[model samples]
Target: MASRDEVECWLTDMDGVLVHENHALPGAAALLQQWQDQGKPFLVLTNNSIFTPRDLSARLRSSGLDVPEEFIWTSALATADFLKSQVPGGSAFVIGEAGITTALHEAGFIMTETDPDYVVVGETRNYSFEAITKAIRLIVNGARFIVTNPDATGPSADGPLPATGAIAALITKATGKEPYVVGKPNPMMFRSAMNRIGAHSENTAMIGDRMDTDIVAGIEAGLHTILVLTGISDQAEIERYPFRPDEILQGVHELVENDPFLAEIND
Candidate 1:
């Protein structure tokens, strides 16, 4: 692991590392407070674009981790930022949860349930034919395809379930179009986060539970990576995979406790 003094930013995973199942994971709050005490920067970053930053902040606060709205970032927001600069008027044919729509709308995009200039897909607990058909129509009519993260599934309290990939696959099958993803493993998404932290990739370390998206994305962006065993990835999975993380931790709490001689913090 890199020395603490060398660290500039700690990019984090929200669901697995900072929280689990709507509850704050043990050590998460303290670790965050530790960062705050040091006046160091961090973020609650996640591929699950199911809540707006304000909504997510409230959720986290209710769950016992009181963080500010600006401290939380999601794939939905990044996707919105990406589309704002690329797609004029930011009109979209979206197949995602309410958060995605909210971010798109907040970004001055005209969100539509039907005919659109782009088809942006994200996680939705309920997948339906009508939903797929709408996206299919957009793609067939030459609408640009964008996806919030390509995770094939999501983490359940038990594990993972059929995810955004499955939905994208259904849409792709219907229209023979593949969507451009704007989450982890996508450098643009990482760049967006770096922009938020005002840090360079060389000084940032992404801590997450998933290897394919989080770790891979960090590596691709030239950022250091830390994989924890608390979420989707396990020791067995790490051993089985060709990709490797720069460091590994059992969970978020262990991360803070393992650091040598906690530095005197300012904030």
Candidate 2:
């Protein structure tokens, strides 16, 4: 693993590493601002496909984070990029919110339900039975199955809500076909973000809270990984995974206070 001085680019998970339940962790914004002031390349990778980057930026700002839309990369955008690469100007039967649809549109994909090239799914509160049935039938009728992420459940004020993975499972059972997951743990999204930022993998570092998704993906992408214990996984849970992060911290606060490279910026 490379030291902090080797990090020329940074990628961090949004939901946990920087914020928890719509609240910013201590020093999260300051750390991001420091990176920005240093002209560092960084991106906030998120699996939430319910909102576009613009919408998410507003939400994060409301919670006291100063991230801009351009600095945010969502699974929806990655999925759209994948689809565009696979079939340029193809159509899709989408079961998602404005995030997914907007990305597809931007990628030159026409949205349809009848004999589309793909059946794309993402996070949405309005997961209707009709939509699922249509998606299943579309897949069975030869449309390829694609989902934004493999997250079975998403954090919510009311508790865990059935996410894209859970809904994708139902459609898989109905059509006897699985979906191509395009978010974290796949490494493709990370590669895309790195490319978008024009950063080499070896010079990048990923800071996240989850071992399964964020850390694993970072390792797979050949980037240094840092796990923070502000959200899902903790020190005790780190032993459960065969793969490990390059470093672990209490939270983003530690990075701001202790990282030598960041210290230079602060000084």
**Each prediction's TM-score versus the true structure:** 0.88, 0.95
Tens digit of lDDT per residue, candidate 2, span 162-246?
A: 8999999999999999899999989999999998899999899999989999999999999999999988897779999999999
Work out how many backbone clashes candidate 2 has.
Answer: 0
In candidate 1, what are the lDDT values of residues 1-267, reduced to their tens digit?
355457778888888888878888877888898889888788889788877888889989999999899988899999998888887586887888887998898889997755677888888887788878777887898888899988887767797798888888878888888789898779788889888889787788888888878888888888888898888799888887788988888777766754432333211
Please give the distance, in angstroms, between residue 42's alpha carbon in candidate 1 and its true position after superposition. Answer: 1.6
Report the Cα RMSD per candidate.
4.1, 3.0
Off by over 4 Å in 1: 1-4, 113-115, 156-160, 257-267
- Shift in Å, residue 175, candidate 1: 1.2
